[model samples]
Target: MVGSENEARITAAEFRGGAGTAAWRVTATGPQAVFRAVSLTQAASLVGPAVEAAERLGILADIDVRPEGVIVCVPDRDFGGISAAAIAFSASVSTAAASLGLEPDPARIQSVGIYVAQHSATDARPFFAAALGYEDLGDGDAVDPLRRGPQLAFNPITGDVPRRGRTHFDVSVPADQAEARVAAALAAGGRLADDSHAPAWWSLASPDNHGVDIAAWSDDVGD
Candidate 1:
């Protein structure tokens, strides 16, 4: 992680987690500071001067800046392909961000993540990937599906969603990378999500079970 002497100390701090520890609250002092996790030896190259700036400004006071272990998210909506869903989310997030005044350039960001699933027989690879010569695998594939897509190029007018069967994989990707992935999905004619991804929520489709949990919608409906 890149930082000034003062910020470097912050970036190097140890983090605690249930599964693993990460470098916590890493700081840098510069105009376009970026704080991301890296091996102890690769700190300087991966961490950049921009992150140092954010640190000098005290942005790390609230969140964990440099963290270990991959954070993953899966879409509540199913796409015909895992890559398509990731791309859809990524593009939509960027459009939303630009409308909000945070104009972050997509190229400088590092490390995007998405989801994979345990596949059984009868599950087909997403059409886009299969067309590109990616083979399917049992249990799962060796590579992540969404990482291969166009970046940051989406069309609001032509956006769509490809229908998915009951069984599939749900993956989470970093917001910026998700934008690039979404561009690809849009190019391939896939649908985007109406709701954002969050940990406390998940969707399960089961014909046998149904419940009316009115409290979930109360906050949005003026209750």
Candidate 2:
């Protein structure tokens, strides 16, 4: 539910990751920022409970369920769509843990994924924009028809990345709230790595040091 057909400018695609991994990222102002599913089956498992819990939290403002994953909507600019989605997934995981009669932190990282591309963001943007019917925002940005909401920020890379590149989470988590989110991620088995020295952007490792980034809001966007 990114938005009503009229209110949204959204588009998404499964990008190349590692050898056997792939993920989907979208452009919109909602919780459906990025979804990492190793496969179609896994996507269903991860997204179902997330969607359910998000709805229950009344935080689920929008959604667009896809076979690969889903795009959920949130409320504001300051809200962390990626983090909210993670929490929703955690809630779903917690519910599953309860159903199994086991005591476990649903917030724990059950799986990790890194969205990448076979080509650089420079090349991927035009390709994906055309493939998904989106408009290229340049500088590694692309959006759906409406040109708003969840968005994909392609990180250009040199050398070899796992499976070239795959999709993962990219959102503007505030600098103040970032440490808390990082702490929570660590508590849940995620490792921290600073990909950027800039005060706002950060890189996180999924215990395995995958290349997913949680960025800070910057004024340089689209410049």
Per-residue lDDT of 1-223 in model 2, one digit per residue for the tens? 4223333221111111112111112223422233433455544554556566666754434443444443333432322223323343434544543453333221211112123354442466666667778765545566665534356567666664545655666545533345566677778888767756555656777877655566543222221
Q: Candidate 2 versus the native: TM-score?
A: 0.40
Q: At residue 141, what lDDT does model 2 achieve?
A: 63
lDDT of 1 by residue, 108-212 (tens): 323211232222333234552455544333333423234333211111222233332332223222222444544554455444432243221223222333211
TM-score to true structure, per model: 0.22, 0.40
What is the C-alpha local distance difference test score of each model? 0.26, 0.44
- The stretch of ten residues in a row with the least summed lDDT in candidate 1 is 211-220
lDDT of 1: 0.26
Query: Which candidate should be chosen as best, given TM-score against the real structure?
Result: 2
Off by over 4 Å in 2: 1-122, 147-149, 159-163, 195-198, 218-223
